[model samples]
Target: MNAASPKPVLEMRGIAKSFPGVKALEGVDLTLYPGQVTALIGENGAGKSTLVKILTGVYQPDGGTIVLDGTPVLFPTAEAAMDAGVSAIHQETVLFDELSVVENIFVGHQLTNRFGLLDWPAMRARTRAIMANIDPDIDPDTRLKDLGIARKHLVAIARALSVEATKIVIMDEPTAALSYKEVEDLYEIVERLKGQGKAILFISHKFEEIFRIADRYTVFRDGKPVGDGLVAEADTNKLISMMVGRTVEHIFPKIEVAPGGTVLEVQGLSHPTEFADISFSLRKGEILGFYGLVGAGRSEVMQALFGVTHPSAGTIRIEGKTIQPRTPIQAIDAGIVYVPEERGRQGAVTALPIFQNITLPSLARISRHGFLDLAKEFEITRHYAARLDLRASNLSQDVGTLSGGNQQKVVIGKWLATEPKVIILDEPTKGIDVGSKSAVHGFMSELASQGLSVIMVSSELPEILGMADRIVVMREGRIAGTFDRSAVDAEELVRHATGNTAKEAA
Candidate 1:
């Protein structure tokens, strides 16, 4: 680590928090030093979110000491956290779409003149100054909706920096939506902030990102601090061990099952603005992996297949029978299911109980003559939850209260309960912990083994390589390349995904 500060900027000691059916955190401790980035490492349900929530003033700790500059403090509300200089930029940048960049930066706390009026010029200047530190090209007057995802993120960080007292910055999967070059820019911003002695709490599931940007590491497992050290002293294996409490021999445990006849075929699939000419086949007892970069239209293809969008022209064949799914009901009735990437938004109804979320699609089955069958709902939910080995306190637990992993399980079970012949998982393991990812992967294998045809759309090459029987690479909304497991490596996949030559990808 760089010459560390003698005193930590913030410290948490013996933090504890519990819920009705879960102990989210237990005696967890964390320390953040000025001028250093500390990686908060953990598996899903390991209390990382709870700790962040406490820090951000969204939740009060049941018991703990939050020390700031050698003084204990409490953030009873989100406003209090901002006033105390604790700011977070989430993976999904939460900003208004129609608002101007300057307005977003100075939304709640706009600069005022002596007359007590909003000082537009002053705010614009400050916005420009903040953008100068990140991107000089972003116009302060530009509407936020016009900028791309990466620029919106820059604005989110700028808004955080606008808080003059922001001493500690928390980045939760900030690079999840960023491209490679955008990620490089974020690293530079991080380094610049560190130079200014701003303590940073970096949370991420990608080990490569942690190794590249973090100086210190703290690992949490089962809601408790298990390890901490300089990142320089740790490797991928050691960190994995800390996160999961076991040697992670394999993240993608691909269980082989001989591929049978084609179960689903996509021929001449085309979307008006998303993807086009998508042709592929998923075999019975096979995992067909779709690999692509952001905006490569993998999810679009899946959405179209699931009847979320109408394909301008396409033919979908299930077991040699061609069908067009114009609505989600049609898709489900035709024995097709999709698990979306945005688990919090689209995959699961966070407000509903676990059993309700699982049995939602199968509601007709659980209901007779329009009367809901509560017991049958529980029975159906139990079967799939057990199949996925989901960890939760009870079937009545709200899906929102569960960790990322359990939430994902609830979504997957919701679809599987429909008894679909073909399942499309779009970024199935995104935003989940490593252990959760392994569980999802293993479950995918088990699904394939049981003759459930799977179309897994993932941006992760390692996952595609490990679990896919055949990989189809998409570039700019079309199939760029196709390869079997034995025929492709990381470089080749990158080449196809980016339309890059071998040397260019290197």
Candidate 2:
């Protein structure tokens, strides 16, 4: 377990890649040895992803070489990379929606019985065996679409393991969508793989996760390898400073502000299958925080309020106007906007241009005589883009190509363009880096300062504590408890969220 070791199982020397103006990676060198987990830590635009793409054959390095198993190898495609015993499980789980878990696991290479037809029994047996090794609870016969995001990810990992991969396994934010219990399960699996002599390249934004799992660590800053050494010898402050090249005084900046009168109210909100009897209120200049375990119906409550899902029973009022929004368009018109938890799915359309995404919802406002006013559109888009400090190829660049933080900015910009009185944010900082998360928090504070009511749903405890003026805890679809800023502690919130305590009414 020492840093000074024999030849690594996989090595990248002087890897460099570039776009038209962005020098994505500049002579970054990484080594992954058998039986060690190497964590690649960096901010959003740092060269971590660039290096991974190069190693996975999604992109060819403009410079440097890759050596696997003591031999130089050139991967022409992703299949070629996998053929050479390297596989990457991305932050976004990519699996066939229409196929069963077993089929997804053995999609490319299926076992045949006698006649060379698709062999279902053999595939099911192997899939079950693989899942038993990693995660046995996932049903092999279930369709991929029916599984939760975390379960789908486990299936992806099982797919990679079914191929008998041995050299290197790269997991990019694999636990981002997982619950606390699921995260522990994933760590256990990682340990098992490490015990089997598999080299793992772990890319994540969570510092605690790296400290717990990583054997060695590398920090990338502005397209260069800024730090590389043993993880045990590194500290959080040092690692964060190296990643962003600055000292972060505080990760969550909570500003003091007075809460105004309630601007939106919900009484006995209930959904047949998702949640029930959830009651809360949001005041102007106040942030209502929702804290609960994943799938505790927090996001579902927000979705029901925003008309994404119909509630079986409930009432919602904005600014003293009782209304049940039948659609998201109506919700927006009613001065309510929802930023969904799945930013990549419900936030922005990646294939659209960044500016187009920013102005997509408010196109009618910028239109004149049934024609789009390009000048006004660009003006509004640039204003928010600059305000958010979004980095992209250009305003016209596809939203998909931008970093995760920038993509999230586009989503926020799109909603802001509507000029809503009430904004609902769900896990707004889920996958973003620390710098971007701070920017988003600042924006939220700024919006609230402008007398806009915000209801934020978050899973991270620190974020809920720092940003919210009032806190709401949900457990199994009901309001477990509510706390004002001065009345709550982390342990108390968790206790109520898990239904361990019933707090008296505020």
Candidate 3:
């Protein structure tokens, strides 16, 4: 526990917010101190973001008192929040794509010369200095569009650095697109920022990350603060349990099935730069779990299998029928569907309504002629929504506004609407709450019971162990080892995944 002696740098007391029908937050309290990172964690719709928005002036709280450095302040706009030395780096980087990194970083606070024109040299120097302060690897001249997602995110943080934000900095899911090396770099930056006595509010779903970086932690559930305090004394397992209000024994709910009838046979599957020589057979009523560390090509292999990426040298057969699917449509036509890991990007059209997102891939089947029949689409959406237990007040709500778990359900609903025999789920439960995770596990089990072949690729070892009848470990784009349900343990899985163990049949 923080001694609770001095007034904290920033404090929110009795914070509350609500929609017309949904209570987004209820009496949430948080305090941020200098020279420490406070991790804010919870299930989706747990009011973590709502609290952040209120702090950043994106959303006005229905009730609360915000005391910053012992002074009550009400931020009416994000700009006002920034002007008061509070800034947030969102999960998705918001920068002008056409602008160069230097220009983007110093946009609002650029150095101007006596002639009232942009000082290119001074701005570039300042950008380089800021990058050096954080990470010298990033180039200032590169256009924001040319940089990868992770780099763009760093650039957004650098924007905060340029302003010398002394009070608080909020980072939302900072490691989502970062490579392992980049994550390390970010940790270094975080350490440096902490030394400067900057109060950082870190938001992430990864327990390992939170454990490694956070000094204090807080949990929110159903838009209210459930737990709060220091991280050193908090148990990770207990924290997850408290966050979801349930004991989470296993994340993977794979059946112990005797695999039969080669449902999907991948022979010599190879994709340039992603993976190669991936050969495996997913049998009917079987859940084959692919486990690997981040960037070990798990999602890439799933994408290749779903025909999102063309295999350079491989033959995929569905029920012994040789199939060469050049596109996702071809894969769907062949009764094979892929529920992508990035639900927001590949799975759901955020702008579209729930019913539209569900029936998008299978609308032709429901339509009589070229003209569409929305009534039939609604029927299908209603059936799947009920079946998946999607928590939406109305079917007309935009899929983007739904919580992570519900959005994931929407993704599954879309693919289930296709009625595919073989379904590939890549990180199916990432960023979702425990309750929603249980729902997805049950749904997967039900799908397998219906004799649907499932191949789930996940980074979480528990999910793989819990759900997979057989686990396949991959390393550097090759099948490292295969383990039957009873044979594999977490250590062995890690060994195989990290290329420490040779190809062993278990």
Candidate 4:
């Protein structure tokens, strides 16, 4: 506890919000002290996003009292909230690809000249100053599209820091897409923000992150505040029980399935820049895991296998047949399907109804000629939705309306409807809550037991260790090592991924 942080910089009391037929938040309370990181722990649909939306003024609360530095206030709009020194860096980094770094930072509140014109020089100088505080090497004039994912997050952080009187900064699942080293870098950035005396509210599903950076914790469950305490006094099981309203005994739930013959094989798969000479075999009824650090070509290899990217020098074979898939349709026809990590953008169409999203890839099966079969659509939708435990009002509900975890379920269900022989899940449980993760893991085991080949690419060590029958560790665009469940541990995976021997003196 900091001596200076005697009181909370921000407080929410009896906060309530509701949608048309659902109460998103109910009498929720949260307290954030200056210079201290408060981790908001919860399962998806725990009213965490609702509370955040209310705080950011995206949704005017149905009823609540927001006390800022002991003075009650209301934010009529998002800009109003930001102007009042509340800034948030979301997981997706709401930014424009065409805009420059400086432009993104000073988007709405641009520095203007005396003549009321856009002040480029002043904005650049200010952007430079802000970027220097975060990362000096980021060019202020670079287009947002030119930078990688981690750097984009950095720019978003810098934008948040640019708030003239930043009293509170909110980070929502900020490390979802980041790798090992990049995540460590983000931790350093967070520490720097803490040093600057900013009240931080970090939202994450990963308990490791909460224990690593947060001083205090606030747990939410089913639209209400369930518990609040110091992070040092909590453990994973305690937090999980509070978040899910039950003890999640089996987080992984990987069932032992005997492997069959090779269903899919990638021989000498090569991408000019992303990866090289990637050779692996996925057997029927086996869960093969791909583990790697950022830029280690994990996702790229999956993309190539799914025919999203062209493999310059590779041979793809399915069940003894050498089939070259140059497109996703071809891959699907060959009984291969991909469920991407970015479920928001790549996996699911948020605007579409759950039934529509699920039936999109397999329209032929559910459609007669060019006419869509409504009954068939609902039949397929309900089946997979139930299989994945997708929580929604109905199949007609927009996928976007669901929580992040449910959205992931919809994506997984959509791909499962295709009835592919082999499935490639890229960070399948990336931002999913613990309860939802268990369901997905159980489903993976069930699929493997049914003789469906599975390739799971994940950054979480526990997930790989728990679910994978075999693991192929990648380092610098190549296979570092391949190991069985009995042969590899967490330390061994990290060592291979990082090329560190980690030799210890006895």
Candidate 2 minimal-lDDT segment of 10 residues: 248-257
- What are the candidates' C-alpha RMSDs? 2.3, 2.6, 3.2, 1.5
* TM-score, ranked from best to worst: 4, 2, 1, 3
Candidate 2 C-alpha lDDT tens digits along 1-506? 77577679988999989998789998889999888999998889897888888888889999998988889999989889988888778888578999999988887667887897889988888898888866788889999999877688788888877777547899998888887777888898889988988999999888889999999998899999998889999999999899889987777766667878888999988888889888888888888899888778998888888888999887999889999988999899999999887888789999999888999999899999999999999999999998888887689999888889888899998999899989999989888888888888988888888888888898888899989998998888778889986888898988887777866679
Listed per model in order, the count of residue pairs whose N, CA or C atoms clash below 3 Å is: 0, 0, 4, 0
Task: Give stretches of model 3 more than 4 Å off.
Answer: 1-6, 111-115, 130-135, 495-506
> Once superposed on the true structure, which residue ranges of model 2 sit more than 4 Å away at CA?
1-6, 113-117, 501-506
Provide TM-scores for the models. Answer: 0.93, 0.95, 0.90, 0.97
Candidate 1: the clashing residue pairs are none
lDDT of 1 at 269: 99
Q: Is candidate 1 or candidate 4 better by TM-score?
A: 4
Instruction: Give the clash count for model 2.
Output: 0
TM-score, candidate 3, is 0.90
Instruction: Report model 2's TM-score to 2 decimal places.
Output: 0.95
Can you write out model 4's per-residue Cα lDDT over 1-506, one digit (the tens) per residue?
64344588999999999888888899999999888999998888999988998899998988989999899999999999998899999888789889999999989788899999999999899889988766789999999999987788888888888877888999999888677876887898888888888899999999999999999999999899999988888899999999899999999998898899999888999999999999999999999999988778999899988889998898989999998788999999999999997889999899999999998999999878799999989999999988888899889999988888889888888888999999999998888789989998999999999999999999899999999999999999999989998888999899999999666779
265-375, model 1: which lDDT tens digit per residue?
999999889998999998999999999887788888999989999999979999999889999899999889999988888998899899989998888898999999988
lDDT of each: 0.90, 0.87, 0.85, 0.90
